[model samples]
Target: MRRSLIALSLAIVASTSLTAAARADIKSPVVIATEGAYAPWNLTDSAGKIVGFEPELIDYICKRAKLECTIVAQDWDGMIPGLIAGKSDVIMDAISITPEREQIIAFSNPYARTKAGFLTARDGKFAKADGTGSTLVTTPTLNNAADTLKSLRAKLSGASIGIQTGTVYAEFIEKNFGDIATIREYRTNDERNLDLENGRLDLAFEDTVVLMPTVEKANGALEFTGPAFGGTLFDAGSGFGFRKGDDELKAAFNAGIAAALADGTIKALGEKWLKADVSP
Candidate 1:
C-alpha cells in the first residue's frame, strides 16, 4: 500500500510538471516585426517607441490570444526574409495578402481593406489622370477598366514613376506601366515621396489610405490621381503574416483578429488612426 501511494504521488507530480511546461510554451514571448517607419500604420515616435495603428491593434490581439508579444522595428525589405530566418515570429506591417506572398508564408484573415492609387503633383500633367474615383479590380479580369487603363497608359507614357521595392504595387506597375514609364524603385516611401515632391518623379503609386496623410502634409502640392486598385490583384486585404508552418501562432492571431473585428475594436481604431473605415 505504501509503495503504491508513493508511485501515485510521483505520477501526479510528473503530470503537473508537464502541464506547466506546456503552459510556458504557450505563454512564451512572441517577437512581432514591423516596418516602424510606415507612418500611421506602424511608426517609431521621436522617443523611439513603436506606436501606430498596427502596434495598437496587435496589442489587443496579443491580449485576446494570451500571447506575450514584443514588437521590433524591421526594414520593409527584410520583413519576410527575417521572419523565415527565425529573426521574428510574426509580421504585422500593412502586408497585403497576394498569391506570390502566400507561396512563401501563411497569413491570418485580413484585418483591413484598402485600395491603391497614384499620388502626383497637383498641377502636374498627370494630375487629372483618367478614371478618378473609380474602382478597378485586376483579378479575374481587367475588363472593367479596359478603356480607363488604356487612357492612363497613354497619358503617363515615358513618365517617371516611383514605387517602393518588394511591394505588390511594384508587380502591378511593372506589368502595366513598366514598359511605358521609367520605373524607379526606392527602399522607403519617404524616399520615393521626396523625389516625387521635388518634381524628379512624375507619379507615385501606393495605398490611397496610406497616402492620405501624405497628401494632407503636402498641403497644396500633392493629390491622388486615377482610379483605386483592389481585388485579387491586391489580394483580400492586409493581414498578419506568419511562417509557413507556424500553425499554432497563426491560429491564435486569427482568433484574436476575428474577435477584434466582431467586437468593433478594429473599426474604432481604424477611424481613430486612419480616419477611414478600413475594416476588412
Candidate 2:
C-alpha cells in the first residue's frame, strides 16, 4: 500500500514535467497499464501472479500480432497518463469506448460487452410511489426514462448507492437517482464492497462481468438483482484502448480482436473465468 501510494504520488508530481518527453516515441515494443481492479478482468491473486482475463487475452493477441509486449500492474488513474508519458505501450484494462475519450485517445475494436446492473443487499424495504418495484429493470432504450426511473426512486427513497468515481456507471446512477438517494463514490470495488458489507451504502451499480469474479469469490455474501441493462445509456461494450494517433497499433489490435471473436477464444475464456459466454 505504501509503495503504491508513493508511485501514484510520483506519477502525479512528475506528470506535467514529463508528458511531452514520454509521449514522443510511443511506438515501442512493450505497452503497459493496470488491470483496473476488476477481478477476472485484471488482478493479482494470492500467489502474487498477475492473472486475469485481459492479461491472458492480451498475451494471446500480442502473440498473434507478433508484437513483443510486456504487461504490468499499475494504478488505473495512472494508466492513461502512463501511456501519454510513454510509461506503457498498451493498456489492456477493461476500458470502455466513449466519444469524450476519443478526443484524447483511440480505441481498438471491442473484445467484450458487459451490461450494467445494480446490486442492493438482500435486506431493506421502502414504501412505493405506485407499482412498488424494488429492482432495476433492463431497458435497451428507455423512451420514457422518467417513468421508469420512478421505480428506482420509490425503492431507494432514503437509501444510499455506491459507485466508482469518474465512470459512466456513476454518471448513470447520479443522473437518474441523484435526487432520490445519497450517492457515495469509492476508489475501488473492494472498498465499495466493504461499504456494502458494512451497510454504509444500500446499493452499487456497475458492469455485471466486472462484478462476476467478486460474486464468485464472495462465496455468497453479495448477490445481484434483476436483468442486465444496456442500450444508449449503458454504452455498447468494453474494448482495447489506445492513445490518440496510434492508428497502426489500434488496427492491429482490432484485427486480433476480430480473429479472437471468430475463433471462439474469447467466448471460451469468458466461460472459463466467468461461467458465462459474454459474446455480445
Candidate 3:
C-alpha cells in the first residue's frame, strides 16, 4: 500500500507540473514594441503618451486577435534585438521589412507601402528631374546591390547628399555615389531635412509619406527629385516584426491586417494619417 501511495504522489506531481506548463503557454500575452521617436507612426506627445498611426492600428489588431496586449517604446536600433532576445513579442515601429532581417526575425503581412524620393530645394538644379511615383522599386540598380556607384555617380556628379546614418538609403548613397558626391550622415531625418533646407546638403532621400509632410511645411521650398525606390532598397511593404518561431503571432496579425484591408479600415487609417491609401 505504501509503495502504491509513493507512485501515486509522483504521478500527481507530474500531472501538476504538466498542467502548469500548459497554463504558462496559454496565458502568455502578446506584447508589441515601437520607437516613440517616429511621428505619425509612433511618437510621444506632450503628455508623454505614445500615440500615432501604429498605435491605432495595433489597438485595432489586438481587438481582432482577442489578444491581451501591451505597447512598449524602444529605440530603433534595439527593436530587432529586443525581439530576438525575447524582450518583446513584436515590433511595430515603422521598420521596413527587409530580407536581411528575416534571417533572424519574422514579419506580418505588409500594411503600408511607400516609395523613396530624394528631397531637394525647389530652386535646386535637380528639381525638375524628379520622377512621378514609386519609380525606384522598378528601377534596377545600375551596379551591384551593395554598390550602385555607376547609377548615382551621374546624377549626383559633384553634389552633396545627406542621409541619416544606419538607414538603407544612406547605404545606397554611400555605396553608389560616395566617390562622386559628398556624403554627409545625420543623426535623424529631421536634422537631415533641416540641412537640406539650410543649403547644407544638396539632396536628401526619404519616404514619400514623410517627404510630402515636410515639403508641405516648407511651402514649395523642398522638392523631391529622381525616381523613388522600392523593392530592394525599400521593400514589398512595411509590417510588424516578430521573433523567430512566432509564426502563430505573425499569422494572427496578418489575418487582422487582411481584414483591415478588406473592410477598408487600413485605407481609412492611411487617409487619416497620410491623407492617402498605401495599404496592400
Q: How many pairs collide in each candidate, listed in order?
A: 0, 3, 5
Residue 276 in candidate 3 has what lDDT?
A: 75
lDDT of 3 by residue, 146-182 (tens): 2333444566688888876666666666776788888
lDDT of 3: 0.68
lDDT of 2 by residue, 97-153 (tens): 777666666777778877667665554453223332233344435664566566657
Structural similarity to truth (TM-score) of each candidate: 0.89, 0.82, 0.80
lDDT of 1 by residue, 98-156 (tens): 77788888999999988889999999888888777777767636667678779999989
lDDT for 82 in candidate 1 is 72
User: What local lDDT score does residue 250 receive in model 3, on the 0 to 100 scale?
Assistant: 81
Ranked by TM-score from best down, the candidates are 1, 2, 3
For model 3, the superposed segments whose C-alpha errors exceed 4 Å read 1-29, 130-152, 231-233
Number of the top TM-score candidate:
1
Per-candidate local distance difference test: 0.78, 0.65, 0.68
Give the residue spans of candidate 1 off by over 4 A: 1-23, 137-140
Better model by lDDT: candidate 2 vs candidate 3: 3
Q: Give candidate 2 misplaced runs (Cα > 4 Å).
A: 1-28, 126-141, 217-221
Candidate 3's TM-score reads: 0.80
